[model samples]
Target: MSRKVILTCALTGAGDTTGKSEHVPVTPEQIAADAIAAARAGASVVHVHVRDVATGQGSRDVELYREVVRLVGASDVDPVINLTAGMGGDLVIDPSDPTAQLPGTDLVSGLERLPHVEQLLPEICTIDCGSLNFGEGSQIYVSTPDMLREGAARIKELGVKPEMEIFDTGQLWFANVMVAEGLIAPPPLYQLCMGIPYGAPASPGLLNAMVHLLPEGAQWTSFAIGRDQLRWVAQSVLLGGHVRVGLEDNLYLRKGVKATNAQLVEEAGKIIDSLGDAVATPDEARDILQLDRKAGAA
Candidate 1:
């Protein structure tokens, strides 16, 4: 019997990719539509991040989240909804005046980032493990220890599983500390994010090391960005972990071919199948991740 692997399709991330690829969904309806399409294409879960309608940048607005969730919930297929709590952590500062925040800064208390999670009570939400120099320029993604602890506790209170987003090895270490401190529940879910600017590079050795560091009995998935997105699916499965793919991480299916979220999920399914593993259904994914099925849908 082949092992079961859960595949997550991250629709539209908080990045500024709308202009680069017209496929990046900017509205709640489009994002939700992509989620449904991905689910039909064999994705066990759909990780989501909403963008502002006017600016096309990531937004922490609860209304956007609510609309997306409602649309997906009312759809035919039911995939596990994993809402992003990774927003509201961006801190862009001026180089000359370090005391002054730049135009892109959206820093807020960790708890403030969970308003949507608190309202919807999705099966799973993210807790970015630590802060990082997000990308080029002075932009920084901030998620301190105190903030993470508080966020984890609140998510726990809401009875939602927190998917710890590990961007670097150090972030993984801090996540382990949280688990040791009895903050994260047993069989914690981890998403090893690789190939982002300055975070853990997209290296098999580095990924293997990170996998080995995970606590025993933990369920985890690993993904890389851009050209490495598809390749990382095979790498992750070989290492006894699940996989993630979609427009949020990569836009092109090949050299110059832009892919839709469903196309990405279908390609990832083929990889898992070729590796002699079967894709887990949403209910199967729920069992694997120890998540309770949300009411309605399917």
Candidate 2:
């Protein structure tokens, strides 16, 4: 483990996990505080997704994102913020009437999904590379090719790095197309998402294949959901990539143990240490990801 691993803490995802863990921050204030804590606990980056405080549902409100970024900027610890641009893509189809959309559908244009990223201009924002079957339902995570191109252009225009979220190999394939098309900037960043329903499963062979598919010199991190979260930390480090952990991907630090974002980050740090590597600092992460240190500043 001679490599310096960049550890990212996904502060609070848009998943329906708030009820399962008290540590899942729903409000802007709580999410910001959790991000700060994760940075203090040895995370070089914090990936964020805002939630509605009243309903505990994932929100696309730019106001909430503004507040979260404002609060994180005000903090002493300076972790590179990675805002998620993967929302507003849920298309829950009606089971009986397949043509009709259900109540949870939030299909919007790619540009519409990136208002917060444009306004805040965080160092990094995610662009999910393709659509997904998501879970055991009629739901789908829509990210069409045209949509991705539009999102990638906007992200580049904002001078923000796009953490291309690849759920399957097909997504990775299309992402390379974007890179070739000059939409994704040099030294593209990728997040190899695994272990979700209908996406790539948490398999060592599959992870290796995905890594092989990445463009040369790409900066990447990999994560799995639920029980495989911590396991994937070591797996990612061994594969010569970075690591992501937090309440977003998993709720437990161990069996029967609920985890806070900070706790999850600490565990990831320990895993990195055990592998004979050190967790990267914010400045180091900036260099590795080819990002400006002050990119997020207003």
Candidate 3:
């Protein structure tokens, strides 16, 4: 078993979660501050997704990402920043015309989905492994195989490590395929995203199945949303994987209990320490993720 387990704190996500947790940072400055707090609390990496300042809704603006990168980089804290490249794939197909795009649909190209990552060239970014129905209905997360290939290639060219976000078994399979296709670099990385509606359920059995599907020599981490967050944190570590926790995935420490991003990271660190596994520091995770001083150099 690996003695050091990396802790990743996803600061904010694209989901409509601003109202759910007051601690969820929306603006670039707030996000940067929360990221620094998370890093100081023990997170080796901070996964970020910017939101529109006016509406607190999710956004993919390059300038927003640029500001976030600048603020975080210039801070005293130096955690590896992993931008979310999982945007620009929303497809809310209309029931009337299956062929025609719906009103709420937000479809963008694989290349277009990465302007922020390309601009900032952060230490890491995410490339969702595959597409999946986001929720109970027609809301879909569309990342086609070709799109994934394109995104991965771009991230590679930018010297950004693409954390393969796997929502289910098929996504993991495709991630392995990308490895074979030379779209990604060696020692492939994965992020098991659990409990997102129709995607992989947040259960130990399912998490194990997905974990087992990882490449023989891959680095991986897993997270579950809502109340399942801590469960998956421990589960991932038990499965020889890393752990992720923060306000993005879960808003509360427990029922009727809210938590800050730093509190979440500290809680996860304590859990890992209790399990006889040390929480990896920024330097330790840098070595594990092969991150160098340059953004995204592994």
Number of the predicted model whose lDDT against the real structure is largest:
1
What lDDT would each prediction earn against the true structure? 0.93, 0.93, 0.87
C-alpha lDDT (0 to 100) for residue 295 of candidate 1: 22
- Across 236-296, the per-residue lDDT of candidate 1 in tens digits comes to 9999999999999999999999999999999999999999999999999999988855422
Model 2 lDDT at residue 127: 94
lDDT of 2: 0.93
The total of clashing pairs for model 1 equals 0
Q: Can you rank all candidates by TM-score, best first?
A: 2, 1, 3
Q: Over the full model, what C-alpha lDDT does candidate 1 score relative to the true structure?
A: 0.93
Q: When superposed on Cα atoms, how far off is each prediction in RMSD?
A: 1.5, 0.9, 1.7
- Cα misplacement distance, residue 251 of candidate 1 (Å): 0.1
Candidate 1: list runs displaced more than 4 Å. Answer: 294-298
How would you encode candidate 2's per-residue C-alpha lDDT over 1-298 as one tens digit per residue?
2788999999889888988989999999999999999999999999999999999999999999999999999999999999999999999998899899999899999999998888888999999999999889899999999899988998888899999999999999999999999998889999999998989999989999899988888989999999999999999999999999999999998999899999999999999999999999998999899996556886
Choose 1 or 3, whichever is better by TM-score. Answer: 1
